[model samples]
Each structure stands twice: as C-alpha cells, then as structure tokens.
Target: MLRIVLLFLALGWNPVAGAAEMGDDGLHKEDWFSITFRDVAEDIVAAKGEGKRLVIIFEQRGCIYCREMHEKLLADPEVRDFIKANFKVVQYNMFGDEEVTDLDGEMLTEKTAARKWGYVFTPTIVFLPEEAPQHVSVRDAAVATMPGAFGKWTFLNMFRWVHEKGYQKDEHFQTYHARVIQEMRAAGRLDAE
Candidate 1:
C-alpha cells in the first residue's frame, strides 16, 4: 500500500486524485467532458443548449505534452472548475481509428481528420464559436487554436478568453493575457512569473 502511494505520488497523481483516471485509449478521463457520437454539428448544438462553448482537443497516446496537461493544468481545481463550468470539451485521439463526422459532413477517421485539419501536434486545442458557420469544417470555423501545452495561468486564461469571446474584440490573446496577468498580480492572486 505504501509503495503504491509512493508510485502514484511520483507520477503526479495525488493532486488530481479521482480526476486522474485514464481511459483505455490512454487519454486522461474527465467525467465532465461531453461524450458524444463525434458529430461536430451535433456537438455544437449540444454545447449551445448547455450554454457552453465547444472545445475539441486532439491528443495521441503516449504523448508527454498531453500527460503534462492532464497532470498539471487540468488537475488544478481553479482551472478545472472554470473550464468545466464554461466549456463542452470533446476529446479526440489524434492517431486513433475512431470515425469522426466533420461539420462539413465529411466522415473520416481520427487520424485522417487530424491531417485534414492540419493538426500536427499532439495537444492541439480547437475552440469553436457559439455559432459555427454552415458548411465549414471545424478547423476553418474555429475562433482560436492552441497547439501546445502552457502553464496554468495561460491555459486558464485561454479558456476564459474564448468564453468571453475575446477573439471578436480588438485585443489579441497576448494582450489579454498580459493585462490579466497584471490584474492578477495586483490582486495578489498570482506571483511574478
């Protein structure tokens, strides 16, 4: 029992505790993530119905960046809770054999979809608007895409930015993040980086 606990601690499993469960597909499982039929259009409708933005995350098995994201950013309760409350996240395995229905009505396997979408990274996160354009693929319709892992503040801020529809504003993500960082520092919620 002690050895098991030690091993788990070494693997960064304790902070997330119950949240660290892994699927057979080797992706970390979050109970709040929407499990659907992999239909992009239907997913948009479902997310709208729930008053949440749509997020599609592409991850591959044995991806260290994916593991880091799951173990660190997603594990932090502030980040986890905010994202769960605001986003309807649908996870896709970048190299998997699962069939996905794109918004343009094209049916392709996960790997093919990744190639079609031009996602070359393991942890590419695609954020869709509240209403996607008709007859467009998710890649084309996405308001923003984060291609790699980031620290907790950046990750959480990205989610917040999308939820706030920051893409539609004059301020870019870098500006928004910088402004928020200053605010957080002023409020003493975050220390200097």
Candidate 2:
C-alpha cells in the first residue's frame, strides 16, 4: 500500500480516484465519450452543434499510463462531469486500424493518423478550438495538447483552462494551474480533502 501511494505520488497522481471500466478492446470505457466516424471536421461540427469543444484522446491497448488516466483522473466525478458537460470527447486507439479522416480531408488509419499527428505517447490528448481551419491537420489546428498522463488536479485544470479559452490569454497553463492551486489552498479545499 505504501509502495502504491509512493508510485502515485511519484507520478503526480492524487491517489484518491478510481476507474471507469475496461472494454473488450482492452481500453478503458467512458459512457459519455463520443462515438464518431473519426472524421475531424465532422466531429468538430457535431461538437459545435452541441455547443461543446472537441477533444481527442489517443490510447493503446495495455498501456499503463492510459489505464492510470482512466482509473484515476477520469474516474473522478468532479473531473469527469466537468468534461462531460463542456466537451465532446472522442477516443482513438493509438495502434488501431479504424479509418480516420484528418481535417485536411486525408483519410488514414488510426495508427497512421497518430503517426501523422506526431503523438508519441499513450493518452495524448488533443484539444481543438471551436473553429478548425480547413486544409490543416488536426495537430496543426489543435489549440493545446497534453502529451502524457498527469495528476488529477493538473488534468482537471487543463480541461478547465481549455474550456475557458485560457490559452488565448496571457496566462499560461502552468501559471493558471498554480493560481488555481493557490486559491484552493487558500479556501482550505485541498486541506479538507
């Protein structure tokens, strides 16, 4: 138990969270995650129609970090509920063979798309702006990208930052996260938890 807690601490995870569940594909499943045709443009449009932003998460089967993300940050209701309310999430398998259409209208397999996007990590999250420029790849159109799993606070703050369009502001994410943490500490929220 001590070792597990230490591991979570080393990984920057809060250690108080839990998992959603695993699917037959060996990936974690979230009921609210969108099932799309894997077309970036269409997905963006759909998300916009629903008044939400599009977010794509790339994961591979049997990835420990991916499992960590699902089991820890994503499983928490506070984190999960905010994302579900504000964003349209799409899951993509890093090594999958499913067809995916890029924003540039180029069709490729999931594996190829991941390669094209230069995603080198499982659970790489790409957050797209409300308007994606045509003839550009998803990576090029992405407003922000999280390259790997982070702690619950960091993860939730990233989502909040993106939802609030904080990227367009002068305050960077790290700074925003720090400020949020400080506020939480000042309010005694972190201490209560």
Candidate 3:
C-alpha cells in the first residue's frame, strides 16, 4: 500500500487534473470555443460548414455555478472531447458591451441580447439546430436551452442527445437521462452511490 501511494504521488496523479484556464473576463477558456464576431446567422452557417452544431454559452464574472461547471463537469475528458468534436461553442458575457448580431439582422449588445433571449441565469447554454429559419431570432429557433449547471451525466447526456438529434424522437430528456444513468451504472462507468 505504501509503495502504491508513493507511485501515485510520484506520477502526480490528480482526479481533477484538467480544468480549463480562466480568461480575463473571469470565464473558463478552452481551445474548443470559437472566437467569432457574434453574428448568430453567420455563426450558424460557419458551424454547419464545419459539420458541427452551434452552442452559445452565456456566463458572467464571479458566478460560482459557472465555475463549478467549468471545473468539474466540462473538465471531464469525455465531456470535453465530445464537445470539441461535435460542437462549435461560443462564449458570451452576460453583461458585456460587445456587439452581437441577432438572426433577424438586428444588432444589439451582449447584455441586450441576453435580455431579449430571456436568459435569467448564468451558465445558460443555448443549442441550435443545423439550420434556422429566416427572420427569427436565435431564441425563437433554438432547439434546446440549458438554464444552469447540472451534474456530469446530465451535461454529457444533453450534448449527446442533441448531437444524436433526439429532439426529433418522442423520448423526453428526463427519460433519456435516466436510461443513460442506468446504462453507465451497469457498465461501471459511474458509481452507484
């Protein structure tokens, strides 16, 4: 037992080893996030061109839940890899003055856009479909909106369901999440506790 402990210590093994770095805006920064002009229509087009779905994540400085999400759930290798492979993520500051163009061709500041979209929480994640209809705002065309932080399984499953286009199916997200949890538990990937 002592030798095993010494080996782990020498190897510098850490359970939470891969947390992303925080940006000057006090948000977690990752290489997977796109640095775009914040134009909804153009972003959607670009994301689709890359064969990836568009995902806008809104966060503010000093949000504990956002910190938890970035540090714990998103830091997980499986979740991070899946997101990087399948989604074009965009980070938006909830209270920022940066200009953003809405899908309907309206220009607004990030804060105004957040209000227009009715997002009341930090760490709100908006998932867009492959194609959006003309003359509609992003909020009107979003397929799914995650309002706040969630557990590792829920967060990963949400991304998976969206990537698989499960919204078109009859199965609800709650049901799907339960099924996924059961499968993970059975596979011993998740602790039963």
What's the TM-score of every candidate structure?
0.90, 0.88, 0.88
Which candidate number maximizes lDDT?
2
Candidate 1 C-alpha lDDT tens digits along 8-70 = 899887744646678999888777778888888889889999989889999988899999888
> What is the full ranking by TM-score, best candidate first?
1, 3, 2
Candidate 2 residue lDDT tens string, 1-193:
9999899899989744345567777888887899999999999999999999999999989999998888767877898899999999999999999899999999999999999999989899999989867999998999999999888888889999999999999999999999999999998886322
- In order, candidate lDDTs are 0.88, 0.90, 0.89
Q: Cα deviation of 96 in candidate 2 (Å)?
A: 0.3
What C-alpha lDDT does candidate 1 achieve relative to the native structure? 0.88
Could you tell me which residue pairs clash in candidate 2?
A: none
Q: What TM-score does candidate 2 get on C-alpha atoms?
A: 0.88
Which of 1 and 3 is the better model by lDDT?
A: 3
Please give the ranking of all candidate structures by lDDT, highest first, separated by commas. Answer: 2, 3, 1
For model 3 the TM-score comes to: 0.88
